[model samples]
Target chain A: MQETIEKVTKVVKKKRAKFPESYIHDIARAAERHDLDDDELDELVRRVKRAYERAKVEKGEAVGTVAAQSVGEPGTQMTMRTFHYAGVAELNVTLGLPRLIEIVDARKKISTPTMAIYFEDEFKNDEEFVRTIANKIGKSNVNDILQDFHVNFAEMNVVAELDETKIKDKRLDFTDIINRVEKAFKKAQIDNNILSFVPSKSNIRELRLLADKVRDLQISGVKNIGKVVIRKEEDEWVIHTEGSNLGAVLKMEGVDKVRTTTNDIHEVEKVLGIEAARNAIIHEAQRTMDEQGLTVDVRHIMLVADMMTADGSVKSIGRHGISGEKASVLARASFEETGKHLLRASIRGEIDHLTGIIENIIIGQPIPLGTGSVGVVMKHK
Target chain B: MKHEMVPDHAVLSKSESNKVLKKMDIHLEQLPKIKSDDPVAKSIGAKEGDILEITRKSSTAGKFITYRLVKD
Candidate 1:
């Protein structure tokens, strides 16, 4: 065993100096277990070196076009349907082509914004604790906890009758609800369990409007979050929320901040900055493609994410974003609104360097890719 | 959450960045870019046009060192 280890180490050191440390260890371990001789180990090292060299990207390769083709071809075969979340019938996630478009476009508001929230150590295994946390995160409007609403037009007042049973079920304090309403409406008065709002004008229309607004007002829980379902995913009880509020969700007591993630890219960007947003885009796109049984390389998705956020902010792939803002005038014109781009370029007296692929392609010249990327000069010796 | 996915980011000094560019035989725009507002970039106080050395753990290779040009 000692002799084999020494032989393997010597062989590894003699081979490619840039060979990864892990690969070296893997070969060394195999050599020890198999007790391979010097000749066999040398052959193995040679084969590994050849494989490594073959795996590297070639110079002058058109990576962008290849990435686009790889992803787009598989995308055409994707089904157009929203998928139901695993074991949850009501929770639907936008999947297939629609989701792919949304991700590339970097839409501010996704069709379905959701969050997968993990619990802290104490609450991870307890279903009861997880349910309580879910209820706390879910939005609670006046309609959810109100027994009745009376718009006293004659008295220029809007009175809300609170349901004690519903409030207790939600684990919300009555005074806290009243305080929130009072803060929302400056002229609000709470006597006992009756909350009254006195409007500035006594018009019936104005009083009715105030009553409507009060009915929809949020009394507790994070705003914008709709239905929250607590389900057992493997051994841990995780909370799946229909709507996403990443900033607020991360601050909750029983929530595991590290494991919680939102589907909205902009929310990730706002709360965690641009790097997290870039990773979110990559992960989301990969997940969407994977659900449809497509196998685009992760590096391709990484390239797209890098391009989208290269300018310090997430931008869509189409007009008003990456394509529209290309440094080359012709490149911008070729993407969209050709006439507008051309007019603007001419007005500004902008010159086209014709160095990029799109511009060269439009002008009937060889694009700057592959063989076209290189320049040659003949010298007589 | 912020620190979990973030790789080790270190801003290269001016001389070192220039050396990298020279060794790679590429212009600043040629290298893959990271945003100036990237959380790792911000934490290290990297400005636009600076180079960031990101060291990531890889399953195939034990460690992989990648560079990104910070862009505004």
Candidate 2:
């Protein structure tokens, strides 16, 4: 079977000069399932060539308008609430329309920031290693590792009883916890595994307040990583985090830095640069549309992503971003705050060049797109 | 630098850049801009004002080609 497939693939490659590489590859793969002779293979290639030609866009096609309609039509049908991310009830993420809006708006701070952390090749399938990394990444407060906090009004101090089992389970050092507590509270005293701190006022209220602070103090793990869920995705163990800290997560050992991604667009930009941010926008918008069972083409999302990141930094789709930054005064005025834009343009003596689509449409001229984009040239002999 | 999200970027030499600009019938300022400090630009040692040919894999077009001028 393998030999036959290879022979068929070779034959397809020989005739792939006219067709696209992807088209040829697809045809070859499809040919593998069927047992076809030379005649049938040649016929299949001929039909694919015709179909490929028909599928291409014409020179004067209005692709931008089509892309806009393709994305916007399905966007109206999306749901509008936070939902559990990928069946992980512990991690709630904003999905559907809200998520799509968040992606296109290029919001700096997302409502539910999450990271999908993959591991290095050796540890990808190792469940034990994944759990350890999750523990190291997930934020843990002092309350999580302590059995109970005893507020002693008589002694004018709060004593925290450490849970040794939990500490060891989290792979945290006892001394590290004590040091953090001492640094936070100048009067903190550490004895063996016990941490006690006396409030300066030395009253019942002060003791209770100090105990509360001690309980809530962060003991270990990376900050902003609220919860970590380890689930096996296909052959490997994948870690899904509630809160994202991409910078810190990428720096950790045994992490596959290339594959690990966060839903936070701005954070991705800050960490990986604009191109990664553009890809993030595409992936996120596509995922959002897919999650809602909407079938908007990827090209539309790609176009939107390209526009947002065209200026080296990610910008929002609406006002204060791409729409507001248009070169034409009439175009900007037409998008939003017509009065403000026109007033500002007039004050600055901005010229309306009528170079773009909206400006041309506003002035009763044919929009400079599709068939209307080109002008006739006359020659006098 | 080897990230899957980032497309393949190659710096165009002075002559090649001039030819590309002439072929496209556009000025250097008309092309999309990439910051000099952009991760991929920095990794590929692209200096300011250099034209980069970016090749991206597209679901629709199979392969899409674009250009960016590195800017400080």
Identify the candidate with maximal TM-score: 2
Model 2 segments beyond 4 Å from truth?
A1-20, A27-54, A203-205
Q: List the residue pairs that clash in candidate 2.
A: none
TM-score of each: 0.85, 0.89
- Candidate 1: which stretches are off by over 4 Å? A1-13, A17-39, A82-87, A148-159, A186-189, A197-200, A378-381, B1-3, B29-37, B47-49, B57-63, B70-72
Q: What are the per-residue Cα lDDT tens digits for candidate 2 across A1-381?
A: 456545655665676635544665566667776766778877887677678778877876878789989999998888766664665767888888888888888888889998899998999988878888888888898999888778877778888889999988887778887878878988878888787888888678877887889889987778778888888888999999988888888889999988999999988887787778888898999988888888988878888998998888889998989888888888888888999998998899998878888888777888777779789999988
lDDT, residue A91, candidate 2? 83
Residue-by-residue lDDT tens digits, candidate 1, A77-179: 9987666564366687888899999999999989999899998898899887787787788887898988888988678888888889998888787778877
Measured by lDDT, the strongest candidate is 2
| Quality class of the docking in candidate 2, CAPRI style | medium
Tell me the lDDT of candidate 1.
0.82
Chain A of candidate 2 gets a TM-score of 0.89
Positional deviation of residue B58's Cα in model 2 after best superposition, in angstroms: 2.7
> Candidate 1 clashing pairs?
none
